[model samples]
Target: MADPLSPFRSSLLPVGVRELAPHANPVTAILMGRGGSLRLHLHGARVEGDMLLIRPGVVHGVVLPTRGADIIYLNGLDFPSDAPLAEALEGKLAQLAGGALEGGRDAVDELRACLAASASATLPSVADVVRAIYDDPMRRMPQGELALRLGLERTKALRCFKAVTGQGFREFKLWSAVQYAAAQMKEGALVRTAAMDAGFADTAHLSRVFRRVFGLTPSAAIAGLSVN
Candidate 1:
């Protein structure tokens, strides 16, 4: 049996005209040859950059330059729409655009091809994978295998993911699970089922992490759930 992957897709849009408007789709992008500024309302955090990453549900617009531009966009689904992933992609995009990143266009092409091929696959962040085991009380992921997938020694992978995500990979995975659990609870999932489906070891385990992150136990949060 194959390892279950998350659902996502990627597409490239040509840079024709620069216009200001909210992103209609959830996208992560690499803007190249951009001679103008891009403005993004990522959760109301005003972010300006030559390479903009518009995480899903983020509102953004761009100011065009008199000269033409070249752009690339990489979108994913398995990761959360947050600052960590956005920032990392932004840095990578900048390096690619400025022709300073290692492997040059070949590297960029390879990464793009990788994403395109895996559009139907679930590719978790290096951070999220680690978290699924360590920080998540419910799902205890095996570190050795995950490290191999990330192409790093187990210890090094652990360290690198932490430095980049601002949380050890395990921590992010658990938080991600917690967020999933919360959403499920809000949708009226029974505690046990919600815990299991969210990849937690058990309802008790889910409760513990939920409390740690939100300062409220899973049950308490469930009580406050309002279906709008």
Candidate 2:
């Protein structure tokens, strides 16, 4: 089966009603309930809503609605660092959560539009780096070489990448690898094969990273899901 999520620049997944263990997401994301409201536990505090905007690096777990949910993972480089992104996005979520959006893909489009309207233009060099990583998660590109390519000092390059993506360069690379592995798994690859394809040291390494970032083992998250 073709990758259902291939057309999307941001990763979007439709998940059935389930519980996700607490984990620190590497990128900003939004979870919208499909047929009912959602309950999120953030830092031991609980909040219930039809839509929830998740900030990067926050430890949170969710109780999805009975019908299911649509999760949209965003590129943090698209938004301005100083803006109140969560508040603004929550407002848009409020508008869309009322059944205004059709599905996960449509929700992604709406959210992309919202971000584009207010986001700052990305730096050319930083954008290039992001493109390269997304294009080939398995590529070995060290920060020093990247800085040289961008005509920047290594420290400046690092700072610029973090500023644009809201994640350190290393963190972004790890997230890309995880996404790559997940994509391979969606295509029916075994955990070991997917781990190797994504450049992880081994299945155990992939499992640890996956759990820390997503709060679930790869098998638990990908098994039984219909990619088609």
Candidate 3:
């Protein structure tokens, strides 16, 4: 199957976190409840709910107990409105929260479907650039290098990239790197290993960026995992 999250999918991680310190993701993040509620702290906007559509670079933290959740990431899309996408997936997530174990996977799959159904066609030039970056998300991506690769003037490339992804080249690179590293942590990789794999200068560097973007130390986020 074609990856439903091509070009614009940021990170799709499992949720139901006991607690997450304040953090920000570079892309839009949709946290949907599987079968429980969460008390969220989104940069001082406290709300408890089954779903939230966080815009790009938004700072938010959540506490999940008992019920599982799926965190969906979006690079960018032309949704008519975020409401329908959130509403449709909210039902699927609520099902999972209602003890529909089978629905857990279903919810995620359907969430992708829901997003894909509403995804706007990305412009070819922008798609080429974004897809390249995503293909090697952990690679050091300088704006000038990206411009050369895309065969466009540095200034034009910068403008075009921002126009499509709504993020500057450097900003997207940092987000992509952090996003990749966080996924590795979920799989039981040590902070150091994840940091190295994600192209950080070192664990301390990764920790700093991780703490800033996630509002919690990398150690804290990895605490929930058992290395297998």
Candidate 4:
């Protein structure tokens, strides 16, 4: 699928029967095991089911068979709440259950439809700012500079950002950067390089935040092997 949004990215991971450390994302993540099932610990809550929807920053620990399972990363969409969005996601799950990767591609249309349905009512107040961050998370200008660019006061900008994303701008920036770095690691980037590129102070910093947010170290996630 051609993602015109440019910022949003999605991919299917390798297939296997495996378990990895519990991890959280800075962006929306759709996780489903084979047969559209999963054993999950979400935000310290135990949930086992056919599918699980994780919002940005929600901690999730997954346990799979000795082999491993596949993962699909869905980014650039807000957490779905309204019926249309929910139904669309459920539809995608149905596609997965049917044993078709087509669902992953089809998800783009569903996401757009849901986005429209949600926007038909009222969109987030800071839609433009949010889009900028969503587009290039690493390029977030300083609050003062961003405020000037948006032609708003810094305080107003902060409030708008928080109201729309339910995250402090600084925190959101960090999460976005860290997730990008993690993605680099998944793609085989060295820890040092990923840290530098993702705007982290150092590998140790990435390791600390990564462990705190995802409940596992970077290497552990890469190996897809963890004890708990």
Q: List model 1 lDDT by residue over 156-180, tens digit each.
A: 8777655544455566566556666
RMSD of each: 13.6, 5.4, 4.6, 5.4
Model 1, residue 111: distance off in Å is 26
Q: List the residue pairs that clash in candidate 1.
A: 6-122, 130-170, 131-169, 131-170, 133-141, 138-200, 138-201
Using lDDT as the measure, what is the rank order of every candidate, best first?
2, 3, 4, 1
Candidate 4 achieves a global lDDT of 0.58
Best candidate according to TM-score: 2
TM-score of 3: 0.74
Candidate lDDT values, in order: 0.50, 0.69, 0.64, 0.58
Model 2 poorest ten-residue lDDT run: 80-89
TM-score of each: 0.40, 0.80, 0.74, 0.68
Which residue runs of candidate 4 sit more than 4 Å off their true CA positions? Answer: 1-27, 42-45, 55-60, 70-76, 81-93, 96-106, 115-117, 120-140, 225-228
Off by over 4 Å in 3: 1-5, 15-17, 33-35, 42-44, 66-69, 78-89, 92-119, 226-228
Candidate 1 vs candidate 3: the lDDT winner is 3
* lDDT digits (tens) for residues 1-228 of candidate 4: 333443334544433435546656555555555544566665555655555555566556677654555545454456664321111236644454223233445565454344331443113335555566656745755898657655779998787666555567887777767677777877888888988888777889989987776556777666662221
